[model samples]
Target: MLFDKIARPAMYRLAYHDPEVVHERTVRLLGRVAPALGPVSRVYRTDDPVTVLGLRFPNRVGLAAGMDKNGLALKAWPALGFGFVEVGTVTRHAQPGNPKPRLFSLPGSDGVINRMGFNNDGAEALARRLAAHGKPGVPLGISIGKSKVTPLDEAVEDYRFSLRALHPYADYFAINVSSPNTPGLRALQDKAALAELLAELGRTSAELGGSTPLLVKVAPDLTEEALAELVEVCLGHGVAGIIATNTTLSREGIAPADAHLAAEIGGLSGRPLAARSLEVVKFVHECTEGKLPIIGVGGILGPDDARRMLDAGASLVQLYTGFALHGPGLVRRVSRGIAGRPC
Candidate 1:
């Protein structure tokens, strides 16, 4: 409540100046201090234990990818009340990503638009950091992506390299092929490409014998036919689960006051994404007859949104733009709500 009423407004004012600056500073500050303040900065902890993808999550709410691209503030997340934290979208090689002003806030619609292009310090860096600091209190899922310089034909080897490097650290792996910012990245989501990629990754996991669950993060922009094909490919390749509905390229619900910002090319997330993301989750859940677990993400802003996602058959829910907007308090609220609800 304090965050929504007081701190959030102050942050909004700062956001008007430079959102990325505030973001980087916050992550860095938290990265440096969170481990030390671990016991003191803690919030609500729910015992609503549920196992998905062969791992137990303390609660349903998790910190989504992109917020901690390089895992800098990893230890801070569980203290802030996230049941789990998915880090990176890290690539094989370090890259600066797109030019500045790549991240934008649409205050009017309570949304964010970003074309960050998977900017990070690379997978080996993250693995080394995790090795030094250790994993957070909760489950840590590592999301891996293709590097910009890597050709489409060699994407398999590219992803394989990162997976091999970070394999020891990740509790689970999220294969990201959804972000619109990366050119030709989404092409990997196609049937043949997806099949080949997952088959090799599946083989890699088998070779490791770790049984680390592999979940694919998909875009909300795919057609029904395309999604069905992707689902089939996942099953064929032995994928453990799916992280349905990454950011959307569609600007359908941007508030008119913020419609001008819609012209900026990137994936749009937050409230506008709630409906479509939920739709995709429900479709996937129904199609799979709830056999495959789904990590619901995209537009969740509060407990109600999280509830709707869970009710729609998502086994878990993740927050990104919503967390950036409402602060960590939102995690407690959502967790409590899910905990108190009848199953």
Candidate 2:
């Protein structure tokens, strides 16, 4: 009640409602308060633990990638009740992202559009940061993406570097070929490209003692045939799991009041994405015959959305836009709501 009525309004009003500015401020603030989050953890953390990809999650809810691209608030997230936290979408090289105003919020539509272009301080920096702070108490999944300066053909080596650099820190690695911001990044999802990439990463994972799991984050724009083929490729290459439905490019469900914001170029995420994300999760579960675990994300703003994703056969669910719009209260609500449900 306080967040929806008071805090959120104040946050949205910050910097004349620029989403990225608000995001930067929030992450910075979280990092400062991290050490004092023990009480927050006691209040919000739920104890319905489940094991997926050989990692034990305190609950089914996890902080999705893009929220903390460089893992700035590592300790703060688990304390705020995320069963686990997936950080990054970080690239191998440090690159300034697209430009200012790349991230936009759609309050009317309960969504967000961002073309953040794999912005981060490079993988080696993140590795050093993690080595210094050590891993958070909960399972940590590092999302690796190709650097913008790296040519498409060289994506495998680019991703390989990040995998090798962060191997010791990650409980799992989410291979991000799905974000719409980077030029031609989604092409990595093509069968041959994905197969080659996964094959090499599988080799790298094995070389790194083969413990950390590798999963793919896919685009919501894919057709059923493309999605099924992607699943087959993942399975063939020993991929451990799939993160269904990253943000979307289509502006199909933006409300009339927010239709003007639909012109923004980037992926769309929030209530508008719920139906398709759920459909994709169900399809992947059926296609894989439940042989592969899924960490469902996209449009999960409330307990009902999380519950639906689990019912659609996700072993776990994650939050990105939902957390951004609804705040940490949403995490507590979701963690508490889903506790005790079967994984």
Candidate 3:
């Protein structure tokens, strides 16, 4: 209610600019303000113990990645109340991402479009912080992607390097073969490439031991046939979880009058994504014949949307654009809603 009445009006004024800059400023501002909230922040924390993919999640609401790729504000998040935080789409090596205006907001439509191209200080930088900080009160999931400059054929090695580097710090490792912004990244999800990538990661993770869960984040725009094949691969590779989606390349649901410069390029997120993500989750659930569990993503802004995904059969849910627009209060609302629903 506070965001609907107070914050939404304030954010509308800045919706015209580039998204990455807006994101950086928002994180810094939240870090400063989060520390002062006191017990108000605790409303987002839930003590329920959930063991998924071999890790004990304090709760099911995870802060989706691309929010803190470098883990810069690691210490501040737990205090602000996130059940878990998935940081980074950190690449194998650091490189400046797509030039400028890579991020955009479509406030009139309650969505955002980002072509961030996986910009980060790379896996090593994130691993150092995670190793130093250990893990959060909730489990920490690290999302790793292939570097932009890395050629398509070498995708496996690129993801492997990041996996080995982040192994110790991650409670679960998310193989981000999804994300539309990276040129050939999504191609890796194709049968031949995806099979090799997951097979190799599975072998290496097993050698490392310790049982950290492995999840594959996928795109909602995929064809039904493609999704079926992906689910088959996931089951074969021992995937412990499926992050039902990443932001979408589809622009169908957003109100045309309000779509921004980002509307021209990049993946769409927020309310526009809700229905499609629910469909994807339902599809994955059905294909697995109710076997593989999913962590639903896309267009979630409040408890109702969160509940919709759960009703569609997601085991857990995550937010990126919703959390950005509504502040920590959104997490609190969603977390409280999740806790109330009997699992």
Can you give the TM-score per candidate against the true fold?
0.97, 0.98, 0.93
Candidates 2 and 3 compared: the better one by TM-score is: 2
Give lDDT: candidate 2, residue 269: 93
Tens digits of per-residue lDDT for model 3, 120-187: 99988888877775665567889999998899999899988999999988888888988999898899
Candidate 2 wrong stretches, greater than 4 Å: none
lDDT of 1 by residue, 1-343 (tens): 8888998899878987788887888889888888676564455666788888889888888989999999998888888888899999999999999998898899889899999999999999999999998999899999999999999999999999999999999999999999999999999999999999999998888888858999999999999999999998988888889998899999988999898899999999999999999999999998888888999998888888999998998999999999899888888888888884543
lDDT of each: 0.90, 0.91, 0.82
Collision pairs in model 2:
none
Candidate 3 at residue 120, lDDT? 92
What does candidate 3 score in Cα RMSD to the true structure?
2.0
Query: Order of all candidates by lDDT, from best down to worst?
Result: 2, 1, 3
For every model shown, the clashing-pair count is 0, 0, 2
